[model samples]
Target chain A: MRCFRFWPALAVISLAACTTAFPQAPNYGNLGRTPSKEEIQAWNQAIGPQGKELPPGSGTAKQGQEIFANKCAACHGPAGEGSQLAPRLVGGRGALNIPTPSRTLANYWPFATTIWDYINRAMPPKQEGSLSASDIYALTAFILYRNDIIPEGQVIDATSLPKVKMPNRDGFIPQRLEDIHDLRARGCGAGHCP
Target chain B: MSSKRSLRRQFLKNGAALAGFAAGAISSPAGKLFAADAPSADLHAYGQRSHFENDVRIGSLAMWPIVPGARRDYGFRSPLQDSMGIITPAPLHFIISHGHEPPDIDPREHRLMIHGMVDRPLIFTLDEIKRLPAVSRLHFLECHGNSAAAGPTGEPRKALAATVQDTHGLTSCSVWTGVPLALLLGQVGVQKGANWIVAEGSETGKHSKSIPLEKALDDCLVVYGQNGEALRPEQGYPLRLLVPGWQGINNVKWLRRIYVVDQPYMAMMESTKYPSARLDGKSRWFESEMGPKSVITRPSGGQQLGARGFYEITGLAWSGGGAVRRVEVSADGGRTWKDAQLQQPIAPKAHTRFGLAWTWNGEEAVLESRCTDDQGHVQPTLAGLNKFWGIDADYYRLPPATADMGNFNAIQPWRVSRDGSVSNALL
Candidate 1:
């Protein structure tokens, strides 16, 4: 008699719970709004190594020489040898295997387009993101020329920058995070080891 | 303790932080209880630490103030030797900047743009973000370049002056309150094949990094609150991406953009700066996880252990993979080991305090701690880590083996002399 009295309430509760098993997709506050075109243009400036977003304009190392001397030399040094104020952009080839490795663009960086991208986003320290498309292309060209990877007369823009490969383009290998898991599961040399 | 530390401690004893506010109270004629004004008048308005307490963080030491060609490459170091527990005080928290001052952003105007590879590209204001469901969790943020075992240009084994702060101060844990990135991504609907997201900051340089979308959706946060208060300006103030377990740089400060993409952008920070070069002549890119690491703080470098008959050996252990499951303390280098008791609230991806009972006999000894994470990954010794990289055993002198590369998590050993003076064993 006591169990029968509560069965009606229990049956109603169980049927209500069944309806919420899968759950309708949450329609939060609908808080985010569509971004305007100007907003997208202002922030979406990250240029990948593929040079998909390189702006129009071309420059040569000859043209880069004058621009680099005036805008970049005070801190980067006149010949791009780097200074107390900045890291070196030239020299230091074949040094990665040594004990005291001096890593620089010539020996370490894997992409030529990276030079242009970095210059566009963060160069000249306090005056970052202030360089023009042509000026950034020229600076990238000048750095490549200084590293002896490019001729002074070579033009660098969206088209040519992607083709001018870095000296150590293949130096970096993609790290597989699962390797740590695999190494722990197996012995020291299970997957790949010393 | 060194004479310099003793002098600093003596100065801090006389109400250093509360100097100007309660000058008359401290300088009273006798041990009287009366003072210049009410205690509430001095502080209590908002909040402040007691005027008497004055443990401070080290701003710059022997090897730091590293100015890398006009970038703001320095930060304050937390005093781990004097640290009491897991949560670093918001004010005393370590602060680092790669470029430009933390922007003086108005929270009302600041916006986070979520574009690329998203079915519904969207922009959310700070107010809008706060209205979404909020969650809080504890995690530790550590710099990849936080070790202090760099040897001299030629002589690598020369002993030097260092403290717990000098060696392992770049890490701090906190209760961060924010929105899970997964919740926001769910709202926007991540498109298929979208595997990476480039996080960009709003500093003058717009410092940025590309994080794996899987990690982003799993545990990442867009945090605005730290340790029960609004985030400090130096700690990305209005907003920051809290990429737990990964190195500090991946937790981009002043976060303003999240650009979803199919391929890694190979940004300079990733391709040029943070990648680790191995012995096989190839560098490792996207090396995200910090290895399990531990360090003894109380009896560590720059501190004197006077008349040590019985002293508790306590330290911190953490991992990027998961919770620290076990920590072993060795008093005679790595020869012998003993398990330390884990403290309560052993939150994953955060600092876990471990204590072991030790009775020191007035003798020379080297102390070290090795941590094992839940994933069965044990911390490596300096020799072992270098051996894995195919480098020489005397690893300190080789910049390529130590400082030049990042992700340094070797066991730190402190040598306690017969006189109870402690210093760095590896240096």
Candidate 2:
């Protein structure tokens, strides 16, 4: 049961030796093969705010409406108008300032690329990662058009997706480490704060 | 000749009676049953209580369907009122998932890819990772959205219909065994300016979250073992990320890939789901670490006491910041407090058990517990927590629905009736 034990003296000696000696990379003999480029590409699918990793695909709002009805309408509701199952995607515009803020994609999402990234990676609940790149773009475009953020005929692709400005783009503030420290000082009893 | 015949007859009669008794015993119902069929005094190789033992986890009836017609995605709270000690049994641990059951993974086929923002991107198989230096530590993992039922009034009375599990059941402590993430990062050689690492799961939903590099390097573990055995399927069978002291979501289960990056990916979960509004009219994202909190597990809500004279009040207390230093129990609803005895070996970022002996006079009394961590952070009252969040007197009518989801560690009170029935205190 006692599988681990401490060796303080040996650990200290090793640490001193490491600092005194000229540092060199310790090779751990290769145990696994390097992954192929295709394998790497398949797993590295996260698209950030800049949309730099968006794959080559294009779709229009009209095409997205059909795909949405077939794939997403069951959970997200028809026309993305909200349902008891999933969140509302279209409305909630200018609702963040109200007492009961309805934080929908149209109102609260800071980056449109997030929409594409999330859909591409996880969506349609029952069948995730089943949609093609073009289908994801179309769904993104349809949601944008329904929210009144984009025109009806606009085509959404890698280039246009990142440019779509969301209403609550400025809603979030960077987390401050100092604020946590201050809270700890006030919340933690006097003289015991971290 | 007469004497010999009498003796032979007597012997024959005795033998006949013995044979009939033996036949009847073998034909009886109890003799026909096997060892497994009924309770026995003998021991088993792997211990399992008889079916007659009624100590079981009571599922909460308040669980609602997640996707309308789908009951598979439903959540079950832990029965806190029925829990006994610091560590929760794996079966009784609270479960919350995003609309899918935990995926079963084969260890042989599993691989953990450490790529992006690293000098030497590498993929590690389950066997290869296990061969590396290992560490075992006890830590408590709690969901960021835990204890939503306990509102600002300090009274979770509505949750009485449900067990304590419904109110504050989404937390558990266990001994985790894994290779330190820092060692893996060192092997991969993290590149400069990499501030974030996105940990992704292989679940059907591809549940993912962005973790700060500082945390990833500090005490994070790519864990594969829990409570001294291979993890349960529900707890991510083959592998999981153990972000000690952080919220449960950050500890991604079924861990498959880790992408080192210069900035947080701001995934849907992190951006839209985890962040909560603050009193300053701003939102705080990645409120990862849990605050100091404690709950009176015994005599908590639904349990009834029979002729209470001398009773022991005990519960579990934990803090994400550090080891719990002291726990205070109040028998008269915070009007008076007494220091409770903290159990030995209080591990950092682990649940510590505390107990106090009290003499009940069979009168109505309110019991509560407050814990303070080594870092000096004390558990806050419900009203104090509401005030910290800038909620006003009309909080019940217009609750801060969005802001108060995370970091909800309010003092829980239990009302003991003179008639020996214990219930949630409506403070």
Candidate 3:
């Protein structure tokens, strides 16, 4: 008899727990409207080392020279000699390995992909990643030729691009990580030698 | 209208930050962390600025400054020399961070855990770790990439005095007080086969690293105090692992967990990014330890002097592998060198301040410094250093093996003009 009496109460408690008090929704004062498709598309683009975000269309080194002369010559100087505004991209091969390494691309940079990636990310300073896929290829080819890495007449395309190797491809050294195990085995502390 | 409102908000925020700095000055046990002799008003104004200061608070163990605002740009560096005795004061020590602001951690809630290849898993609260027997010693920590630009054949030889604090200034030595990692590893019972130990931080980026397990069982320390005082928020408050003779990056900050493993943690900061220079014309996977170098500080760059007379050329010298036994300063370029006076109680792996007095002939002259650590290793020049490492491996600056190359100890030359103007001119 006592169990039967508590059962109904338990059922009523469970039912009560299930119900939630719903208040009238508060009004949210609207601020800015949703962005348009064009706005969204403009911000979504990014170019990876493998020409991931490259746009359609093709261009040749001949066209790229016109673009380079009109746009890049001011800062980079003719033939990428580099003015005060920009860094010299040519020369510097085997320079980083010399005592007191200068750390330029020719001397220290390990990957050719870095050139493509950097150009896609931060070239022109003002207009970033605006070049079409063909333009990028042409620019890369032109720069490589100017750096004396590639033949001036060599044609650069998707299939032939990845094959190019940088002089500093093997430039990096492994991190020492300073195991400090030997130091400890020898009994070293802050001040007193172990 | 929006600009006006924002200006008002800025005022309120500044007011609040000022109050916080003032409260810290008064309530903290160390008292005014900088310029205590001056009135509170002047000190408050000085605190509001964004420049690094030279004055250090008296009685603080480590020579650190109470940085007023959060990280605005790159963090500040502590002065290595001009300090006597060991134990860098907490306020005056060096500061380095990548982001806009340094993380602030609450010690009461903080805990460090050891996991992975350990026989037994363990977690120790900050309080529990503090209860263990502590050891304090003065030591220096240098960023691996320190002096990356100031190598052989350049103007701004005095870049050492000015730039040292910027690049190498990431280093500091203080009487760190903490429970040894060996004790902690002993408690957890490190697994037999485990060779590498990876330490992870709780900061914004979750920066992590893999150190040799032997190091964890050796002299690595989980420190809570610097220079006999509680660690500052900027200097990895609550707990920071001190790995002597290693690059600053390997010494994990805001330490949270230690995982024992068979292989090293090839985190981005280590394998791909930091490592530069390959042997088969390929990358050297790992290179560590900052080599010997010296920089003059008192007559550093970007300072307006009252009048040029007899000024002492003084600066700090240090190494990672061992103690700095000797330091030489050259005022007439590297053609000749004079021994600079080394401060006493020079502990191994700590900054040794050296000074030399010179009377300027009121003409232009070059200034540079060199150091020899406890180990037989000597600083090298850029030209010599490049021959061994290769031009590609220019990212990190390791300790020099000889005075011949590697650019570790390229003779720094600071040119002083007749008008008392000091500039880095490669003469």
Best DockQ goes to which candidate?
Answer: 1
Tens-digit per-residue lDDT, B141-256, candidate 2? 88766665323212332444323554566778888999899888887889998888889988877877888898899899999998888887778779999988877888888999
Q: Scored by Cα lDDT, where does model 2 land? A: 0.71
Give the interface-residue alpha carbon RMSD of model 3: 15.5
Candidate 1, overall lDDT? 0.74
lDDT of 1 by residue, B199-218 (tens): 99887778788888888988
Tell me the tens digit of each residue's lDDT in model 2 across A49-134: 76877889999899999999998888688878767667788776755544445567887777788899888877877578899999
Worst 10 residues of 2 chain A by lDDT: A185-194
For each prediction in turn, the share of the native Cα contacts (below 8 Å between chains A and B) that it retains comes to 0.47, 0.30, 0.10
Clashing pairs in 2: none
Q: Per-candidate TM vs. native?
A: 0.84, 0.83, 0.57
Where model 3 places Cα greater than 4 Å from the true spot, the runs are A1-194, B1-75, B79-88, B150-167, B278-281, B303-309, B389-409, B425-427
Off by over 4 Å in 2: A1-27, A175-194, B1-46, B54-74, B150-157, B160-162, B278-282, B397-404
Could you give the C-alpha RMSD of every candidate to the true structure, in order shown?
7.4, 13.6, 17.1
Clashing pairs in 1: A85-B69, A86-B69, B1-B304
CAPRI-wise, candidate 1 is: acceptable
